[model samples]
Target chain A: MIHKSDDPVIRCDGVWKIFGARASEALDAVRSKGLSKEEIRDRYDCVVGVCDASFDVGRGEIFCIMGLSGSGKSTLIRHINRLIEPTAGSIYIEGQDVNALSARELRRTRAEKIGMVFQNMALMPHRTVLENVAFSQEVRGHDVRERTQTALRAIRAVELNGWEDKYPDELSGGMQQRVGLARAIAADPAILLMDEPFSALDPLIRRQLQDKFMSLSAEMKKTTLFITHDLDEAIRIGDRIAIMKDGVLVQIGTPEDIVTNPADDYVADFVAGISKLDLISAGKIMEPIDAYTRRDGPIDFDAWPEAHPNQSLDQLVDLSIATQHPIVVKLDGRPLGVVTKNALLRGIKGDTAPAASAA
Target chain B: MDEDTTFNILDPFSSIDLGIADSAGGIKQWAIANRDLIQPIKAVFNDIVTAIDGALNAVPPLVMLALITLIAWQAAGRRTAILVGLCLFALGLLDPNAWSLAMTTLAIVISAVTACFVIGLPLGILAAKSDGFERLLRPVLDLMQTIPAFVYLVPVVMLVGIGNVSGVIVTIVFALPPLIRLTSLGIRGVNPSVVEAARAFGASPRQILLKVELPLATPTILAGVNQTIMLSLSMVVIASMISVKGLGNEVLRAMGRLDAGKAIVGGLGIVILAVVLDRISQGMGQSGRERGQRHWWQSGPVGLAWRLTRARNETTPPVSAAPRTEVQSN
Candidate 1:
């Protein structure tokens, strides 16, 4: 699921956003005096919205920023499109510094390179679904027939073909969000900025949309920076997840890296509610077959239940339950490691013991 | 001395006169000096009033009634159209001269409302976009709304000179604040996230205003327009004091001789026109909500024609399909 590129589609380097008139002064203090967010607020009356956030989103990578409310995950995403300009630092889209661009060039970058979807599904209430979907292209002054065709294609992609003529208010919450997605993709932008786009939906609808978006993103190979308060959602679809807390990114890693080794208590608490059964892979918790053989006697690979190295913990649990012996984790019929019951238990507990030893 | 003898709070400054007359005289002098610029602007207003009044008068009274009723039917609905038709008919029957006067009054109101939008829409948009502009406009709008109409009446009459153009100018001054305030409110009330989405999608400020914000704010803006129309109508009668020709003049002349019966007729005429115009404009605002609900060929007179033609085509023989094909090929 991860698409690694040497030149990332989106790169934020020490971007800081402080809200209020004294933001620049506060930013100076932050750099020189290392003022805490509270001290900065008290002294300068400025709230640190995003503080020194830096991340790279590779081409086609779904980089999810997960945090609780007021964690500044939303603020961090806005910097990509320059909706809220960074109080300091630089953001590059396709290696072009966003902040350095002139207003016209910035607009051009937004129209040609980036599209954003909002949590509230901010579709124009007066516009039909088709018009909403076609908005970006229309703003770019594309010919009516051309944009309409593009819009219809996107609408069909989101499975909103029949509802294209209906206004946003006429649609249900989930459907309206689908229109929002369609609108973003209709522009065919290289990067998609989604700010908690499905967080407002019911759980079932959210899951459905997440699945739909994942499939669409994969098929289209759209590099996306997704903002969400839900850790489960980040773990579900993100190639890499960045956990934000109070304007700072505390952790950035693959789902397995995050769950097994949370950087601090904040991230650990956030991931505590999330089930690791699906996120942890057999490869992650498996010990090298040689290590298992060194500890015990020679093992017959045939006696143990076999599973792929990529098999999730949840799947491995089922295989473990069916057999009394450890499971052989293999890749292309070559045994790579073994997942013993002890290792499996530690994995389920989200303990890094097995993964740490395996590493 | 007065403060020492009597317990008067403002005794010391009571004898001092503010330069109120001087400022008034200065403004008058400025206006007189700016006649070259004001003349063209005054001509534009005069032309609009004349054009509308002439066009309205060109139509026979019964034809005008039917035309307005038809318009109400399309813009509002059947019930409102019926009410409008009945009211116009009643006015004509009640006062022999009511029809012509009503036309003139309608012209003045239309011109004034148009002027209000011309002056107010940009101000409203400016207010919506900038806090500083809104802060400045807030007090001005308050002053415009709170100051008595008669307070500015003399100044406006003296500056613009007494005529239909001056009447419209006065009416615009009276009717404009609500349009500006409501327009600003409507634009401001647009979902911020929606505006942000537009910005995120790279919409220019102009595009966002036209394609997203303005369209979404239509119902509210239309409500503002409805208020403007009502305000203009009320002001039009008072504008008769400055010799603007309208139903207001009819009432004014009737009142001058203390002709109670004639004044009653004229007053009733004004009431009937107000109700009709008010309902029509209000209905238009209401219909703004249903704007996207129907097909383009399912609403107006075009829709009526389309429906009739479609019905005929459907009922006709299959042979008609050949002609349609031929027409398309041609």
Candidate 2:
């Protein structure tokens, strides 16, 4: 199951968070004596918020955890940033165990390495938009001038150029979310954790913000863990989607994989109504396009211009559409094969093409 | 105590009492001459009494019952108003003069309490805004409220000495607490959010208090005013002990002579006054709540006077306005 990839920027291992009075004892009983679920419930009166959940978030990936309310998606995301302490687990961010850090160190880690955008926007009502955007930097003891300059730039980056002087209440819901995003990024943290940030907004505004967020992420290339209940949103933004049910990680895969090959009935039920053909892309199913192939008039150099063989079928389709030519897919800059529009369409439709195989 | 301290405070003012000594001396001569006038005055009083009696007698028991029914209908609803009306009829029968005495006592107490409210509210607001000033006056208000009405008499008798002024002063002392307490409470209880909203936009504390807090707390504060009026009414009988003429003195006279009828009449009068005043003030408070308008005029004479002065000042054109117009024209 190990994919050929770089080491994950973030990793969580056997995370178990039980909430109740005798949580520690229940955890011990389960670990040492292998207590049954009923026995644990009877003895400790506990709720297993996160039970043995593990995942790795790759660098520059918009990894989304999709779940219904109370599905521990938020809790799992919070554990990575250490906003909430896990009962029994280890979360490593950039090779450092977050749980082993002291309170000051945890705060410093949050300040320096992680940025969180809350669902509620959680902007301090007392402050103006500019001040809220600068709060994290201010908290890190940056001088007023430095933080203010950083905040102004971040605000501009979020397309909130004119709203710096306005209070949180003065702005509409969508604008406030932008402010929240700007505030999260103002300190330039390495990773961003968003917990249902756009759920509170209107549909049109949510879509607009989602598009903006994708473009921003593409530019910034920060590793992101976005928790959302909306399935479509997860598909739209997440590079990898993790589906959770009742505190257990049900399935973790690309959106195409989740749609085509769900791990269990639960995952199947989730992706049941979705049109798999539209969701799957050529890059997800195509072999690398051959770069050195002899082709008719103007080989559209950008179409299959040197890329790894593992570039997803979706990326290949996107490149095919962008370059508007038959793609010469490359593996390590060597021609693997050629994938034309028909082959891409076939790949998108879940067809196996022998001619479009990687070299 | 020195001899001078022992001497009554009123002694020096005895010279200003022009009519009393002469009237006492001439009482016998005047009575002999005005014997004819006495009969006519007595006749008028008898006629009035007969008229009242006739009016009561004319109403059938059924009519009285209906009247009671109507009262109950009006007060809280049909039932309570009817019950109250029946109670009133029973009280009227028990003591005829009680109604008039009660009305007069109520008027006096209400007037005094209204006077205290007029003075106390502004003082409370002023104190609330200034911590040092509020601290300074807090002890004084505590003593005023806690010290018995009779204890106030010791100083009041020393100063003004046993009359309506002294009675009014004592009533003010007992009734002033609620006005101060409520004004402070109302001022303090203003929604912090609303206040912050106002301040965030650059409103001063005074403006915030007047525009936001005071308006919001009016109903509760008016309730305090209602309690103050009720307390003042309760003190009427006690105030009468100091020679202040009212139903209380009549009750005192009845007690001195052991006359059950007279005592009952006076006590019933006080009760009637209490009920009537209670209804009116309670009605006013309800009306205030319904209107929900914090207009200065609705507050009372002080607010009315403030508005009048404000209006007068506003009538005059400002020098700046004239200059601005000239500049614009130029």
Residues B15-59, candidate 2: write the lDDT tens digits. Answer: 344576567546555555665655564455335434444454456
| Residues A1-359, model 2: lDDT tens digits | 33344678889999998888889888999889977666788888987788789999988999999999988998888788766689998998887898898766766777677777878786655467897788667656789889999999999988998778666876899999999899888888879989899999999999999998999999999999999998899999999999998888999999878886788888877887664555764345544433324323335555344434555566665666666556665655656656666766666555444445433
Q: Which candidate has the highest DockQ of all?
A: 1
Model 1: residue B122 alpha-carbon error in angstroms: 1.3
TM-score of each: 0.91, 0.47
lDDT of 1 at B298: 56
- List the pairs of residues colliding in candidate 1: none
Worst 10 residues of 2 chain A by lDDT: A289-298
Q: Could you list the CA RMSD of all candidates, in the order they appear? A: 5.0, 20.3
Q: Supply candidate 2's per-residue lDDT for A184.
A: 82
TM-score of chain A of 1: 0.93
Over 4 Å off, model 2: A1-7, A32-43, A277-279, A282-359, B1-330
For residue B199, what is the lDDT in candidate 2? 31
For every prediction, compared with the true complex, DockQ reads: 0.77, 0.02
